[model samples]
Target: MSGAIEFWFDFSSSYAYFAAKRIDALGARVGRPVLWRPFMLGTAFRETGARGLSTTPLKKDYARHDWARLARAGGFDFRLPEGHPLIALAATRAFYAIDEDSPAEAARFARAVFERYYIEGLDTTSARAMGDFAAGLGLDGDRIAAACESAAIKDKARVMSESAVARGVFGSPWFFVDDEPFWGHDRMAMMEDWIRTGGW
Candidate 1:
């Protein structure tokens, strides 16, 4: 990949969670750097008139079975954390804080929040949980916690959500090779092929 691939994700989306763990390998194969951008799905949905997965019985049912299939196919241990819907705006903004510190590690930190709420049945909105999650990533716990509460980061998240709207993104795990957007993990292979053949 001569340029870069943008991966826009939301922490609470099951598909985004799955893609994050595997897209890096796909990028490596194509010789491209993955530019991870975390955004709020709720904002995107509000603007685009899309609904959350949990609210859609058909999609939610499909996801329920699909997640099990994915776990087996990908050889990753899978467990649905809880039934509570996650509000990811704060956590998504927190990603920008840890991003420059370490992109790979930052992704892990964001994923930790995902796992905590989605897989471990933990209440991530708790101040204590956020601090503990930050500490686990070797980040300054207090600083990260404070940053999450900052108006600046909150604004930053709003910007990212608007940016996604501008980019015509309506969902999570959206990948872009330049302006060409790929919307699902299944398209990851095509992303790799595009990179190897020199970006389209």
Candidate 2:
């Protein structure tokens, strides 16, 4: 409660979508503010010489089943899109554009984007889709679209991705309670414990 929980996520990550749905309420319960950071997983992948789980053959198959199992356990609906592991640069950029001005508002926008991609199976990578989502949040859709292409916004996103890598973020759905780092959606309970007890 004394410090913020830094949440690092990639829009293309299904686990990140899972965490996004619940992080806010968890933070509120603990009297802590969550800092939602949307960064490109591709950048970290390049640094680590790794591909996404959905890109691996056997691992990909297991991931689908595991995601579904987790959804069932949590009592939420989850359907894998026709193509998994979507390219989400547009959605990430759009969130950053809104985040520069309002972090809370950006979090709301991120939830909408997550639902669009993970639930409704909509395209989160297209400028049009991102603009439409932003507009639905009462933001200026055209301006949001334009900002995605702006050098400043692009640089901001680049810096955030690099910073995340430099800070040892190797995967999506990572959280930092101060300098302590936790990874994966499955680690949320531990994260909440860390927040409540200040880590053991």
Best candidate according to lDDT: 2
Report the C-alpha lDDT of model 1 over 2-74, residue by residue, as the tens digit.
Answer: 4678889877778887897787787787667888888888878888788987788799888879988997898
- lDDT (10s digit) by residue, model 2, range 1-114: 348888899988988878988899988999889998999999999999999999989988898888888888878777767677888888888989998888888988988888
Off by over 4 Å in 1: 100-104, 115-118, 126-128
lDDT of each: 0.76, 0.87
Worst 10 residues of 1 by lDDT: 122-131
lDDT of 2 at 102: 87
Candidate 2 Cα outliers beyond 4 Å, as residue runs: none
Q: Each candidate: RMSD to true structure?
A: 2.2, 1.5
